[model samples]
Target: MLAELKELFATWIAAVAAAVEAVMDRLASRRRVVLQEIDGDSFTARLGSVAKGAGLRPVSFRLTPHGRPEPPLSPQWRAALRSSVVEVQMRPDQVLFREVDFPKQAADFLDGMVRAQIDRLTPWAAGEAVYGLSPPQPGPHDRIVLMLAATARAKIQPLVDLAAGLGAASISGVVTVPADETAGTTIRLFNTRLAQAGRLAISIPRLLRGLLIGGGVAAAASFAVSAYLGARLDTELQDVQQRLNQRRAALRLNQGTSSAELLLTQRKRSSASSVMVLEALSRALPDSTYTTELRIEGDKMQVVGLTQDAPSLIRLLEQSPQFTRATFFAPTTRAAEDPGERFHIEAHITPYFGSGS
Candidate 1:
């Protein structure tokens, strides 16, 4: 189960990484403008120019506070803003900046932690504030320092609305710098548009589309591998089954040209043979003795016949190798139709007569 979770996490990471890389590549090739609002009636505009080592050098131009170009350069500047990504910088007085200290452990969740404390950090309530945080820096002890910038939504909404009305593609971010501080200490108030309901609406879909295409490709590859393994397993099973069938056929062929019935008959003949027993009896008894009835049951034999001397017949039968325990079962008596005496004898038949005789 842990293995499956790790695999799922890896897939998501790959998808997100791919999406970010695509967006970054697109942005790297494009130019952008920075608009710094000085007052209600005027602002400074800087067009970004690519420098050595993929850096940007801004070319500054002043614009009217209405987001239109000023003086002789108005038309050219207006056209540039429409085609480039716009970042607006507001005056520090229009936004609020506060330094808040938090435990170093809260670094991972600084955004949520700071937002939750916004009401206490500033006079504005959470709903009335548009806020953002600077990257956390080391504090005095085991704590981290963050600069939280916030402003009433009413104060910043009008400027965003004006930029949208001027046909800007999208407002990227809003930052502010105190007149008494250096440019490095600029505080970001709002990184997303307040006038638009969903920030990154267009970019979100583009990233999602890239992720979907990558996921589809991964799914297709997995299916192809599964199908290939399944087919290979099936083929191996068939080959094994065919080999077993061939071995069975070879065994049947080697057993001679007989069906199941013929094999059974041969086995029965080898176990017991009545003809061999009869031949052994004929050799053991004299021609002078005549038999009227004879019966063989398993290894025992019974005889009812006429003999010149019935008592002597027992001795003769017992002396034979094929018979044992010869004795008279009934009394010998002379009969009118009989030439001599009528007698009954019984004996055990040896198994040697069945197979060897």
Candidate 2:
């Protein structure tokens, strides 16, 4: 149960972070690097310039067979890689591509569906391969066409691992497939950036959409809690009012009985209300204090409660206009199971006829 609670807390934190990811993007490093994976071995790279998403002229690097680039890089390039967004585009021949059609309604579940049948569709099992799907395209008979690209993890792990080892700020694996009649100009097949700093990550537009969705969900929850509390408070107020009405009716019945009855009625009208006493206590007590039991006898009241500082409660109750002569009635004690000190306090409840109601 504790493990589940911790996991739930972590998930909530992650969701909150994701909701505010857009604000974080404003402080992110924009330096970019595009590494073109060549011959399943080496790469030709381009560094980002003043222009957004554009890179400098591509430079060929002598690289090992699907391993590290040869001749350690200069400090300048290494430093750039530390904060640069690195995108590795694999050669078309490196990835296996296929087209699959499904009911358009299944578009949202395409990732799970493709992954489930990956072994049958590709040469490798799901776990053995890195896979991705292109944006769905509308097809005949209420269907959608999806392009699937998959490759052995062994083929891509080296490049991703190398980028991370070099301390690339962010890494991505991308592949280009031969576009068909159904496919427009763009078809993004795969992206795997589990490098030192994780992937290039979710896009800004998606992040903003998530923020809006989270806001909507939070607003709905607040409304629900507010409505529930409002209903409960109204019910409590009505019950208190009903009790006051019953007391007033009983007093009126004995109004002209005798001199004793007249004095009793006057005393009853001038006495502090139990509801008012409770309200005053609730407002005066610190949030850390919780009352487990309460007793009212004549003009005095005794309350048993748990608090972080039992002695401080006396001063608080005494300061309130509704209570006075606050003192501990029983010794404060702490039990092994109790979270805080438990104390019994007695206070004089002052009567005031400030309002007839």
Indicate which candidate wins on TM-score: 2
Cα lDDT tens digits, model 2, 84-175, are 67787777777788889889899888987988999999999988988778788898999998788878888766766667777765566777
| Best model per lDDT | 2
lDDT of 1 at 143: 96
The deviation in Å at residue 332 for candidate 1 is: 77
Which sections of candidate 1 miss by over 4 Å? 1-34, 38-74, 119-128, 167-184, 192-243, 246-250, 258-357
Q: What local lDDT score does residue 75 receive in model 1, on the 0 to 100 scale? A: 52
In model 1, what lDDT does residue 216 have?
Answer: 96
Expressed as tens digits, the lDDT of each residue in 1-357 for candidate 1 is: 999987776666656654664575376544466767677445666765544113333334444345334443455555655535567777677677787889999999887787788899988888888887778888888999877778887665555664565555555546654545434566556644322223354455556667877999999999999999999999999999999999999988866666677778766654435676677778888888888988888778888888788888888888888889998888899978889899999998776653334
User: How well does each candidate superpose onto the true structure, as a TM-score?
Assistant: 0.46, 0.49
True-vs-predicted CA distance for residue 66, candidate 2, Å:
8.1
Q: How many backbone clashes does candidate 1 have?
A: 1
Q: In model 1, what is the error at residue 86, expressed in angstroms? A: 3.1
